[model samples]
Target: MSKPRVIYWFRTDLRLHDSPALKVALDLEPECLYPIWTWDPHYVYNARVGPNRWQYLLDCQNDLSSSISKLNPRSKLFLMREGPTTLLPKLFNSWKITHLVYEKDTDAYARQRDIEIAKLAHEAGVEVVTRVGRTLWDSDRLVEKNGGKATMTQKQTIAAGDKIGNIPRPIPAPKFLPDPGELNLDFESQKPDIDADLNAPHRSSSDKSYAKIAGPNGDFAIPTMEELGLTPATTPHRGGETIALKTLAAIIKDEKYTATFEKPNTAPTAFEPQATTLLSPHLHFGSLSCREFYWRVQDVVDNYKGKASQPPTSLTGQLLFREMYFAAHAKLGFSFEQTYGNPECKFIPWHLPSKIDPKSGLKTREYIVDSAQADEWLNRWKYGRTGFPWIDAVMRQLRQEGWIHHLARHAVACFLTRGGCYIDWERGLEVFEEWLIDHEPACNVGNWQWLSCTAFFTQFFRCYSPIAFPQKWDREGKFVRRYVPELVHYPAKYIYEPWKAPIADQKKAGCLVKGDGSEFEDGQLKLYPKPMFDFNERKDLCMKGMKKAYSVGLRGNDPKVIDGSWSALFSDGDHPLGRVEQKTRVDVDEKVGRDRKRRGQGTLDNVITKKE
Candidate 1:
C-alpha cells in the first residue's frame, strides 16, 4: 500500500534550508508531494504583495522546483488562485489528499485565512497540520511567570520587563526528510506544471536594462505585471532576491562602517548591505524560516566571540524581532487604520504655489488650484517629479526602484504632510501604496499618520525640511544627483541649494534658475523661486501643529498602546507623552485575525522610533 499524501503550502517562508514546517512534512514520508501558492485577489488589490515580492516569490519557487527535480524530476509547484479557505478545500477534495502541512502565521489576515481554511478542511475530512516558522520564538513560546507557573498573555502585547535574558533557544530543523515518490495522491488532478525554462535569467535589452537597474538587486528577470494578471500599478523599486542577497553580503563585508549601524540616523543603508539576507521575500513567503536566519547570525556571533569583529549590533538583535511581533499584535487590538483613516479626508483648505506674472514681474495674487491641480501634483510627486530637487530625487529613485531606505521613507513622508503643510496624508499614502513594492497598508498608514501627527501621540510630531535634510543624509549630493540628473551640473557645495548659486554659476552649471538667461541671468542668480517656504517658517508651522496635537492622545491613552510595558528608554522628560508608560491597563480580547480594526496585531504600533 502507498503512504498517505501530504500537501505543504508555501507562503512567505521560501528557502529549503532550516524550514521547520517543510522538515516536518518531509519527515512524515508522504508518497506524493504537493507544493502550492494561493494568490488571493484581496491581498493583491490592497497592495499587500507587489511585483518585487511576487518576482522574488517566483524565483524562490523556481529554485525549489529545481531542487526537487533532482530527486523527483516530475515534482512541480501548483499556482492557484482564490483564498486559501476556498482553494485548499477544492484541491484536497479533488486530489483526495488526506493531510495538509503549513507554517502558522500570527499576522491578522493570515490567521483569519487559516481559520477559515481549517473550517473548510474539517468539513472535507482532511487533516491540516501547521507548524511555526519565521521567528525563533513563536508567540506561544513566550509568557509571563504567573503564580509559579508560566502563563501566556492573551492578545498581542509583549511581556513586561526583561524576558529575553533567560528565554530558551529556538528549535532546529529535523535532520531528514521523506522521499517524494512514496506519496499516494491523484497529482494529475492539480493544475498543469509551470515551465522551468521561462524562469531562467535572460539577457536584457537597453530599455529592459534601465528598468532592471531601478530595483534593489536589478539584474534578475521578473514576470511582467500582465503575466501575474496584475493591472499596471506603478513600481519604483525593481530588484528582487538576487539583489537582496547580494546587497546583504556587501553590508556584512564593510567592517569599517560598523559605526554607521550604531546611530539611528546612520544605520546600515537599507539598499547598501554588507551582507544581504535575501530574507524579506522569503520571510514573506514562509520558505526560509526567521528562526533559521536568527540562528545563522547567532552562530556567526558565537564563533566571533571576543574576536576582531564584534557581534551583530543590538539594533538587529533577536529581541527586536520579538518586539516587532508583539507590537504588530498591539496595533491589531485597536483599529489603527480607522484611527488615522486618511486624515486629509476631513480637512482640506491647503495652499498651492502662487502663479508668477509674465509681464508685471510680480507673483500672481491668485492660485491656479483645484482637485485636478492636486491630482496633477500627486501624480508628479508619485512619479518623483515635484521639482524640489531632493524630494523629487528620492521620489525618482523609488519610482525606478522598488525599495528605499526606511529613514528615507520617513524623510520623504515628512517633507510632504509636514514640511509642505499639506492637508492630506491620504493622498500621499495613496502614492506610496501605488509605487512602493514593499508597501504595507498598515505600516504605511501608521507611519505616515504618525509622522504627520494624525495618529498615536501626535504631541511630538516631526517633519524634515526639504532643503536641509539632503545635506544631512546625502552630503556629497551624489545621492540626489544620481536620481535627479537635471541638477547634475551643480557643484557639491551648491548642489543641495541650487537656488542659492549665483547666476553666472547657474549658467556655468548648464541650466539657469527659472531657465531664462537672455533676461540677463547675471549677478547673484535670483532664479528658482527662493525656497518655496522657508525652513524656519515651515518648522514653526509644524511646531504649532505638534503643540495642538498634545491634547488629542492615542485611543484615550489605552494602556496596551501606551502602557509602561511599552515605554522606550530613550525619551526625554519634556514631551507630553514621554516614553514612560501610562497607568491605564488595556485589555486586548480578540484572537489574532486579518481584521485591522479589532486589535493592532502585526502592526508596528509599539516599535521604538527614537534613535539612541
Candidate 2:
C-alpha cells in the first residue's frame, strides 16, 4: 500500500511545538506531508480585525514557515490565497493526497467549516484525523462531561474536568518532517467579494493580498500588512513561537511569581511591566500551546514549598476560566457570541440593540442607533474621549497597544454597559474584537457577558466605579498620565475627575477641562472633555434597569425576546421598569432572587474581598 500522502492543515495551532495533530500525522509515517494554510476570506473581510492583529497573525505565519523550512528544506507552510472550501479539493486531487489532519477547533465557524471540509475529504477518499490541543481539554468533551450542558461556572468546569480525567501532557515537536510531493497549483483562485468588506474602515489602501494565488513572488510567502492595505500597526507586541517560548522561559524562571500568582492581586495600573503574564496573544495565535503553559505553571505549583494561590484567582484558575468559556461556546455554538438566540444570556432592553436578521434569527453584525446620545457615548468611549480619565486612559491603551490589564478591561466594559451608558454590550464587544491582540472569541464574549451582568455573572448590582476602581490601583493616577497625556499635569485628587479641578488649578495644570474632546491645537494648552454624565445618577439608573431586567427574567431564547415583544414588557420606552404593574412582578422578583441565591451568585462584597 502507498504510504499516506498527508496534508497537515495549520489553523489555530500555528506552532510546531506540542501540536497533537502534527504528532498524529507524523505517527502515520507519511511519504509526503504538505503543511498548508488557506487564507480564508471569512476572517479577512467578515471578521472585525485591525492592523495590530493582522501583524500578529503574519508574524506567527512567517515564524512557522521558517521553522518548517528548518525541519525539511523541501516543505514549508503553503499559503493558498483562497477560501478552503474551494481550494482544498483542488489540492487533494492535484497532489493525490490520501490523508488530511488538523488540530480540532470547536469555535462555531470552525465547527461548521470543518464539517463541510470533512464531507468533501470523504468524497475525495481522504481520511481525516484531528486532536484537541487548543485548550486544556476538548471543549466538546467538557460539555459532554458536564451532562451535555455548557460549563457556566468555574465550579462546573472543575467538576467536568475532574470527570474528563487529567489533562494530557503536551506532545514533543517532531525532529524530522517529511518532504512534500510535487508542488502544483495551476488551478484558478476564487477570491471573495470585497464590495462590503466589514474591515474596509481599517484598510488605508487598496487590498492587494488577493491579487495572486501564490503571493507576489509566487513563493507562497506570508502576506504583509502593506499587501492587505492595513494601516501601520501601533502595538509594540509581536507574535511568534520563538518569542512565545522565550517569554514563557523568562516567566518560569521567576518560580516564586509563577507558583503564587493571583489574577485579582495583579495591578492593572502597572504599565511599564504589565502585572499578568502577557502570554494570551500567544495562546490566541496558537504560538504557545495552552497545555504547555498549563503544565509548566502546574509543575511550579507542585514543587513550591510556600502556600500557592488557588483557583478563580490563581494562574491555574485563570486557565480553568478559559476552559469554562470554551466549553460554554462549544455547547452553545454561534449563539454563544450574541444575546439574541443565546439561551444562556440574559436579555436587557439596552439602548443601541443589535439588528437581528429575521431569516436567520441572529445578529446582522449591525446595530440600530436607538439613542443618538448613546451612539455618541459609544463613539467617544471607543476613541478614548469618554471624559472619565480612567476609562479614557484604558480605551486609549487598548486602541494603541491592542492589550490592557484585565481589571482595566472590566472597568471600561462596566462603564460602557450596565454600570454607566446602558448601551448594548455587543457594541463594546465589536470594539474589543477590532482592537484586542489576545481577543479569543469564547473568552471575549464570555468576559463581556460577565462584565455586563448578562451571563456567567449575575451581580448587576456590583458595578466597577470608574473613578474609585482605578484609584484603588493607582492613587497617584500615573497610569492615567501615561495614556491620557492631556491630564498629565493634573493633581492626583482630580486626575480621575479632571473637570472637578478648580479653574486656577486647571490653568496651572495647563490643560483646560472643557469642550467634548474634539478640538486640539498644536500651540494651545490641551483641552479635555467634562464627565459625560453624572456617574452617581447613571449608576442608579443602570442599577434600576438591571434590577428591572432581572425581574422580567427573559432570556435570549424567550418567545418575547425572539419576537421583539420584549419591549412591551418594559414600562418605560426602551428602559426596564423599576416597578411593574401587578403582584406578578413581586412573584417574579422573588423567584429570580431565589434562583440567584441558589446559583450562589456573587455580590459586590465578593469582588471587593477578592481584590483585597
lDDT of 1 by residue, 1-612 (tens): 767677888776555656677777877778766776665444544333434555545666666555554545555444454446555776786667778888876555566677788888888898888876655455444433222222212222234323534323445543433443332322232332222212111112211211211122321223344445443434332332334444444544543433233324452123443123333444445444455445544454555534333222332442343433334433342233322112221121222322223343222222223233343444445555454667767777665655666567767776666555453565566556545655544456556655665543244345666666667656677777776665678888887677778878877877555631113234643333233345566556655544533432323133423332322322333222122222122221121122224323222111111100
TM-score of each: 0.66, 0.93
- Say which candidate scores most in TM-score: 2
lDDT to native, each model: 0.48, 0.87
The residue-by-residue lDDT of candidate 2 on 484-564, one tens digit each, is 998899999999998889999998898998877676532467889888888998888889888988999999999888766
Best model number under lDDT: 2
> Any idea how many clashes model 1 has?
59
